[model samples]
Target: MVSDVLLGELAALAVLSPAAAFAALGAYLLLLRTPSERVVSRAVLSALSVSLAASLAIWGSAVAAPYAFVPVKLGHWFATRSYAFELVLLVDRLSATMMVLVSLIALTVGRFSVAYLHREPGFARFFLLLALFSTGMLALVSAGTVDLLFAGWELVGATSVLLVAFFHEREAPPRAAVRVYITYRLCDVGLLGGAVLMHDLAHSSQWGEVFGGAPWPGAAASLGPGAATALALCLFLAAMGKSAQFPLGSWLPRAMEGPTPSSALFYGAISVHAGVYLMLRVAPLLQRSPAASAVIACVGAATAVYGTTVGRVQADVKSALAHATMTQVGLMFVEIGLGLYWLALVHLFAHACLRCLQMLRAPSALRDAQEIRAAHAGEPLPPLGLAARVLPAALVRRAYWLALDRFHLEALQERLVAAPLMRLGRVLDRLERRWVAALSGWPERAAVEPGEPDAHAPGAPERAMAFEPAASDRKGART
Candidate 1:
């Protein structure tokens, strides 16, 4: 309809607002202009406000039309004989609602950061990452093509890692950042592979072609059960990492190394729900594959139990909340797996708002605990019922220890995944060195001093300094 054209322009405006903010802040930082905290905060909030307004308008239009699916064309980025890429944004109830939610939360978090991070050294940097995430999330929610979605997905992942390592001066933040990055890289292969398969099977990456374009929730998937199963499994792998399910769940608590505000926004609210959103968006394709749906349900149930158990044993408030988030998100995933689409969406939105508030008020946790204690006159509360009471004492102790160690999931990942890759890397490094030596027609140990020895030398450190002046002649050379 012609009215949908107006809605399309509005959708474009919504996506562009946060992008503009990112460009503005990026320009200021790159130019070495010391931005005032107030100025940066105002600029970001203003952009978010504009984006929020546009998203509301889009939602209004979608409601009026009821079942309309509008696509706003931003032109093709490239084309070839067999492949093409375009920037297209879809407007439906699902996407419009998501845009509204993302903008609203981003605005709230942006405002909170201004006061919370006042005069901190990396104040500007924090805002920059926030703006980047806002832009990416908005784009991802609205993307109508696999190519566009992948672009937005990568942007969000990059910002997540950077924010995790915001306190670069600290040792733990960088290590946590590395872990997050590695997990993302490994899990992202699913998304990358899914996109390729979409092109190969559908011959086009557009939502209309890929999912038969019936306007979400009602859309029929174009793929057969077999192809759909393969695609869905690939996407499930991506969702597992993003949602922190099972073996991939260890990184969620560790991500708390950044500032509290970031922990609130990224893990507590938006980033953690990205995987669930992905599942909801592709629900139609999932319907074509019973196997994929079963896997999703099983994983979600397992994650819920895992999160709840680990949360009980966490020593710190943030980590406890992180596990709690995982628990709730797992429930949402289960809802989606059971074909309860609207319920899952509502769960995602409500959980996000609630978790944001809890994370922001986390610092006051001690004060709140004291108030409760005083109210109760220092008496401990009665124990809540649990299965532990029925178990033997030794078995209870073992369960407690297992829960405390987060079931050793991180250790399992390192041994099964990281250790093997590291060993392979070292082997390849040796082979590469041999190849280079062969190509250059030089012996591998030629650089070592006669008495010093090579890399394989015994009883002494390998003095294999490359092209260094002889140690005996160093004094004369200096003279």
Candidate 2:
């Protein structure tokens, strides 16, 4: 019983340690001046260190009893007659493994950033976001209920967008951040919808309730084919956005605008694999629904192909590595769809380590290449695997053009989706202004439109007042 209590406390600490650090840092930034660089770095590292220790302890306990499942119930947030929201954390082999991975990687990144971002203006802000991200990721992996998972998922998404736009002064970073935000917002509908469906179908959103009390990979969800398919696809939609698969993946390479440590922590390692983790968590749903599995496999295969083809044509080292990461994540998704859950997990862990190292080294890649060329006496290197050598010239040229242009995915998305939505927003804004003018007894022509000069501006003609104070009141005020 004492051991159980200790394990539960450790699980809670694993999540709350980083959260407390984030709160402290955020408070300092808001109520007081930003802390010194050393202070910020040490605070973040200390938080992650504590989290890592707690996670390692949990992992040790899990190892002692292999495949151990421990659910720590904090309490119920609210309870309705038909529905109750509970806060629960699950520490099993899967979540414990993920917790250790997240904590270790975040700790390493935090330490690396102390030097990498030295003397930078936004150093404190970057560490603050990193701490918040650690908390979110820990919460995500340990969440035993869909509601808690969604909260963590949003935290991860929000922080990812902010980090991608870390250099907010730059034009490109903000634009890329917007693109990522849009993709996440659209895909998050799947997670929310899936949660609602789970509640309605299972009478609860708890994993134990939805998938039975058996352990993962063996637990079978008690749901029919149609219901399982709907839920699985919805959840997979959320995964697709987070994972940066295929058509939704253009925002990833652009996300390289952030600092290297953030790039490594988010895109290369933890954040990118979040979707696959979600899928693995619900493996039984896919097993129940063949249609869902087939769709997942097909999309994963297409994303792998797309990533490989485009990755080859990227001019920059970071973009190429981003696409390579995407290809590997795509294959992991395929593994999950094929019901190779353990293999997918192993692949995820190994790939995350490799990709994080590559992202951190990306800035030095060009210098390394130049040094190699210098050592070779400036001799022109042979094109060892040029497509031109084997393929027809015309076909090779066409393929190169397609790959270079990223198959026009961005252009097509703008034309079909973004452009129309923007026009509609503009129209809605004009209509809202007209309605406000009508209700306020102002002339329709006097209504302000977007991008137009305001009538209240200094140089513009003043509009007639809708009302005036009484003359007696005005005279009293003067007196």
Largest lDDT belongs to which candidate?
A: 2
Query: Which parts of model 1 are misplaced by more than 4 Å?
Result: 390-392, 443-479
Worst 10 residues of 2 by lDDT: 470-479
Please give the CA lDDT of all the candidate structures: 0.85, 0.88
Per-residue lDDT for 286-381 in model 2, tens only?
889889998888899999999988999888888899999999999999999898999999999999889999988888999998998998897887
lDDT of 1 by residue, 11-123 (tens): 88888888898898899889878699988888888999999999888887777777878778889889888666889999988898899889889999999999999999999
C-alpha lDDT of residue 300 in model 1: 94
User: In candidate 1, which residue pairs clash?
Assistant: none
Show the colliding residue pairs in model 2. Answer: none
